[model samples]
Target: MRMTEAELAQYKRDGYIVFRGLFSPSEIAILRNETARLSAIEADTVIRERTGGVRSIFRVHEADGATRSAAFGALVRTPRVLEPTRQALGTGEVYVYHTKINTKPAIEGTVWMWHQDYGSWQRDGCPRPDMGTFALMLTDSSEMNGALYVVPGSHKRGRVEPYYDESTSYKFWAVPKRDVIEVLKQSPAPVPIVGPAGTCVLFHCNLLHASGHNLSAEDRWHIYISFNACANAPKFTEKSRPDWVVSRNTKPLPIGPDVLNSGTEAELVRATSPN
Candidate 1:
């Protein structure tokens, strides 16, 4: 799980890196098995949230995903993911802000536009440190499974404007062709992650990134955990998934609000509150 000086330098300059075997075969088996088990339940089990009439996939924390996969949770603290991040951020003072799983079905039109992760946490120009996001593949990920597309080193451009709307998938869930061309022409080309079932990608929150369509024969499932340095972060942000929660550990975060809760206080509040 050791990240070399060269790899750390690459992340700082190139913006993202892929580690094909972040999880062992047995570990991947457990995750895939559990994910299938959850999906088999009759009901949609998945909760959905809307932003201006657009439905964003959301699933309840600990309800749809495994509650006790130490192997998986260990990813949050794993040297494979953390050491590199610490090297990139130059500190181990980190916090696990939030986590959510992504499962994209095979579809010719499915898309996630290229955008930075900053806007979701920024409010009123309160400059804050961006979170580091890691995507772990539960299933084999490829261009067919709508693999992620990233504009190498785009984080240097500052936060790109995010556009959302209810009109069409291509509109809200697409990276502008101009930006794609701009990055390609001016910077390194977007790299398509190609790997076996257990590939993991670590990306900076401010990286201008987007995922491609998953028209292949396999389902592309990914779980992302947001991590941030305890240093220089804002107190809170005005955002929530309503379907997921954030768990706090030794390191603290400066986030405003979230739709999901995982702390003991939140559980107590949910218990006493009427459904």
Candidate 2:
């Protein structure tokens, strides 16, 4: 489950790396089902597009009781995910800052403007950029289906000052067009992250990335789990977003059994619950 030296180097040089077919088809099926169940819920955490299509569901890793997904709970603790995350962050321990599923439905999916994730994380009061995100594709992603596009090695540029924009269909801080242009000038063309279901893309916090609208007839869904070094947890504030968006729990996660391979719902819950 550990990252090879070559993979680590590629991540360092490019700010991200993609592992195709990292999870089994059965595991992806479970995640797809969990996504469907969560999407139907009536909650603030389930953000929808202007057209009423489910956009993103936040804090999925912490879901409890009827809403909980044992599969996702186990995913956070999976060695294939955690070990590489720990190696990439160069930290002994890490915690889930938050987990979210961003869905782009057929032709109704909207665009996510170019931005660095740390732009929002910094505003959330996280002082350091020692964070990474593991995005697991629940459905096949392709150019026609709104695959993510990332600028190679953009993390080396550090955090670019982002402006808050509410005009977009989804409101959030976005990198200015000028800044993105400048970054693109030095780097190779932005790479579209296209892969089949069960693919995982691990990227640095400051990596500049965005996704286009889904013009195809197929849906694209991906669950992203943002991990923060335990030593680099954020400072909470009255102005900060809800805990569902910015997790308050800073406890390091314990590695658990591979539920994708074998583990009952009760065992998965007990293994991931806080001590």
Candidate 3:
């Protein structure tokens, strides 16, 4: 579950690293099914894009009865996930800031502007940029399917000014287009993180990245597990977004294994829904 020396070096240099098939096929299948079921449900957490496709389903890991599901909980807490997260952040302990399914819907998903995740975190009053995201692909991500495009080593640039745009199809505070162009001129060639369903991309919070539209006939579903050092938790009490979006819980995750198989199939099915 821990990263090798070479892998750590690459991550330090590139600002990200992809672990292919880090999760087994059986585990991936369960996640895919669970995501589909959550997306179909009528919930306040499920957001719709301007194109009328599902935008994201937030905080499934912290959702009511859903949190009782062993599989969903383990996806974030298991050593395979948690340990590397702690290592990358160089923190002794960490907590799930939030976890959600970000969907690039088949045929109509829109572009995510070039941005650093830490920009938003900074606005949330997190004093440090010592956080990162682990994205688990739930479906094959190809260049044509809106795979993530990252500027290698861009994390070293630190936080950049976000172009505040709320009029777009997907509202986000992004790095301005002009800044992106300049960064591209100096940075290494942008990398398209293409991989299979079980692939996981562990990326630095300050990494500048974006994804284009999905013209292909397949959805790009990625589960983002964002973690923050327990010592570096946000300081603001006044929040702009829902608690689910910005987790209120600062409790460190407990280590466990095989949480998915710990319960019967019937139990998992019943626990997926909050109601």
Candidate 4:
């Protein structure tokens, strides 16, 4: 689906724009099933919370063989996601920097500290902030279930200084609390990105955002596909993370049809394979 002129303008101003029910219920159901299967696998890519719950699954776009989910492999190529991402980055040629599924299990889920994604990516050697993420909700997200909170227009500040934070269950480069407070004073109040299953939010990489702990009985699950301009591929750095986390593959992805409707697992893999 193509983005409207208004949607593009909103993204430029707000640093994010939400598309309600962007994916249909059937598609989201497929993703939810795939998420459960991936979370149960014991692998290095499956990062766990301090409580041993699955925190996130990285490089989901690379799943193949018996582990592959045709639905998810197709998601990476789906124009509904890729087209707008191309528009946001102002480049028709783009590659997947990485893809991840973040899961906050009921009651036991942990908090993600306030930070700009670019804060971590910059250290990975990305030269510019010309990147965006398409975060699709696999389950309904609400204030009680740890919905993401984003400071509108915060991306205009560009990359804010970040401190390495280990205070949370998951370690990440976080914006200092003092800096966050100062930013809040100048920008609008942090808005909770609340929405139903299948809703999607495309956000700027430099946007300041965070999420609280899940206080309700329901789980919170969201899959993120981060895209960068092919010309903006990162340079190797001493601090560069693993390929799964920081991909070295800068190949521009070829858009695929809605494979979810017609392809088998093996066909889908071949159709979208980075190789």
Per-model TM-score versus the true fold: 0.72, 0.96, 0.92, 0.95
User: lDDT order of candidates, best first?
Assistant: 2, 4, 3, 1
- What is candidate 1's lDDT per residue for 114-222, written digit by digit as tens? 6676645453232574567877787787776778778788877766555553443323333356765776688787888767877988887778777766677667777
RMSD of 4: 1.8
Q: Per-residue lDDT for 180-247 in model 2, tens only? A: 88999989899999989998999999999999999999889999999999888877778879887788
What TM-score would you give candidate 2 relative to the actual structure? Answer: 0.96
lDDT of 3 by residue, 95-185 (tens): 8888878788988787888899998888887889999999999899999989989999999999998878785565768888898999999
Give each model's whole-structure lDDT: 0.58, 0.88, 0.82, 0.87
User: What are the runs in model 2 whose C-alpha is more than 4 Å off?
Assistant: 63-67, 262-264
**RMSD of every prediction:** 7.9, 1.5, 3.1, 1.8
Off by over 4 Å in 3: 63-70, 167-169, 261-275
Backbone clashes (count) for model 3 = 0
**Minimal lDDT window, size 10, model 2:** 62-71
Expressed as tens digits, the lDDT of each residue in 227-270 for candidate 4 is 98988888877767988878777888878877655446677766
lDDT value for candidate 2?
A: 0.88
Q: Quote the positional error of residue 13 for candidate 2 in Å.
A: 0.6
